[model samples]
Target: MPKDAMAQKRGGWIACPDCDTLHQCGPVKAPHDVKCANCGRTLFTRTENPLDRPLAFALAGLVLFIPANLYPIVTFSFHGVKTDNVLVTGVYRLAEGGFPGVGLLVLLASVLFPALYLMGMTYVLLCSRLRQYPGDFALTLRMTQGLNRWGMIDVYLLACLISFIKLGQLATVLPGPGLYCLGGVLVCTLLASLGFDPDLLWRRFGARSDKAGSWNLLKPKAS
Candidate 1:
């Protein structure tokens, strides 16, 4: 039987993340990237060292996160007086201005959530690299996904730029060390998420096809 036909018989199929087209999932030769059949988008590439890339990203994110919250993101100068704003100061300013709701939102999405997200991702990657189970691996993976969406460092950066433009006429706005660190944080976290493959973790844990959920939709059938 043809590979695709046999895959269908064995319920080993995978849906493309981009186009949702079903394809028989099977092991490809090492060092080749997999592409979606319908849209031809790259699905996952085989890396010479899978754990190294993701682990490096996660560590970099964690390192940058500290400076992101510590240094002043921007400084405003008016009439020769200057004021610096760090991550917490921004949140406090929002609250003091009577936008308590917005303050809380900024606190969670920008400050606390991003920290947790980075830490969680770092922990997961470390555990996977060590080949050691860290509590419930699947549950940690799901939680990390939720945190990933909530971390809005990029959105915060956009807001800072808008504020700089609008406030520039009234005061001189200068990007600070914190602003650059935040940018680094965003880049590192994004790269970490992109490099890590959840399917590899599932397979490592010995999950059966039935337990693979949506991932099994692409499994190639055995010959």
Candidate 2:
């Protein structure tokens, strides 16, 4: 039999997300992580409060996201005159100053993508907690996972710090409430993503892989 057919025969095999190596899935005690044999990437772990932990972090990230965008991220002072700028301001300024592409990139990376990610994650967690899968569950979940790289708030925050250091010699730059809030959002979103378990979601929701016609390892059994 082919490898895929062999995988089907194994009954409880899981493909490694990193290297596509199939490993038989077995229940393990808490505090132990399931690692991929080929790539050594962690596939799963017995988390005590999987849903609750990520849900809390997602909620916190959503809350902080509001203030992160609304308030000024930082303030710049030149010759005693000060000006504060929010997240969008930098994008607009970048566009107005002739870097429209960079502005749009920043807008998507810093503002748009983070908001979508937070909302998507919040919705997914809510549905998972309620044991209900909405019509758009799969699409939403896939998009949330896909945008993980595009949501670059951490990178944006680091850029802010670098700007602060570089501009300190010419003028004064101070952290604002929004900057702190953005930091909080970044931290919360990161924790939420880390704590989130896709396998758990698949098992609970009976999510099927559209690509793999015969793969149903995590498919929930009918009652």
Candidate 3:
């Protein structure tokens, strides 16, 4: 018969932060706070809540993503000549304005990155919920981390706001509702990514699947 998968063990001896004493803890089956057995120092406790929190955020992101992609992210008026551009449209405008390089950069930063981040996050959340053990959990974790860096929708929004503020009289600029919705989605996705604990995936699935450990082992140990 195949060996039993390594499930997360709940009860264990945790090192006391204050006294350096090892304290026996009961099963941490839920999110709560516990005290060290010897020093009574408070310690964080968490259960296998799965990916419910992240899933909720991902769903919210999906909802907001519609507007972010559908409506204009920025609107500009120069001498009463109004022009509105969404994320992709901005890239096209930049290219047409003889800034092909900048257009490519913006396309990668604002369009591709945000979409990839959302899709990756959604995949991870759904997979975790289904209890489907990914062959490379570490790869998924790294993808999520990469997504965090690439999600620049919020930054783009800020840039638009700053530009609008500075060009108030010369050329009026206004943000569209899509911009606000995209901003919301960006924030929610970030929060969801941060709150997601990759360790939880290993716990629910199995240890052999944790590639993070391999990565950790490759790193030089601290003195």
Q: Considering every candidate listed, which one attains the maximal TM-score?
A: 2
User: CA lDDT, every prediction?
Assistant: 0.76, 0.81, 0.69
| Candidate 1 local lDDT, 1-223, one digit each (tens) | 2432232234345568788986766654435677887799876665544567877887888899888889999899999999999998977989999999999998999988888877777777677667688577778777876887898999999999998999899999999999999999989888877776655555455442342345545677999
Off by over 4 Å in 1: 1-22, 29-48, 208-223
In candidate 3, position 69 carries an lDDT of 81
TM-score of 3: 0.68
- Tens digit of per-residue lDDT, candidate 2, span 100-145: 9999998999989988998888888789778688799988988988
lDDT of 2 at 137: 91
How does model 2 score by TM-score?
A: 0.84
Error of 1 at 222 (Å): 35
Each model's TM-score? 0.76, 0.84, 0.68
Clashes of each: 6, 0, 0
Please give the lDDT score at residue 125 for candidate 1: 69
What lDDT is obtained when candidate 2 is compared to the true structure?
0.81
Return whichever of 2 and 3 wins on TM-score.
Answer: 2
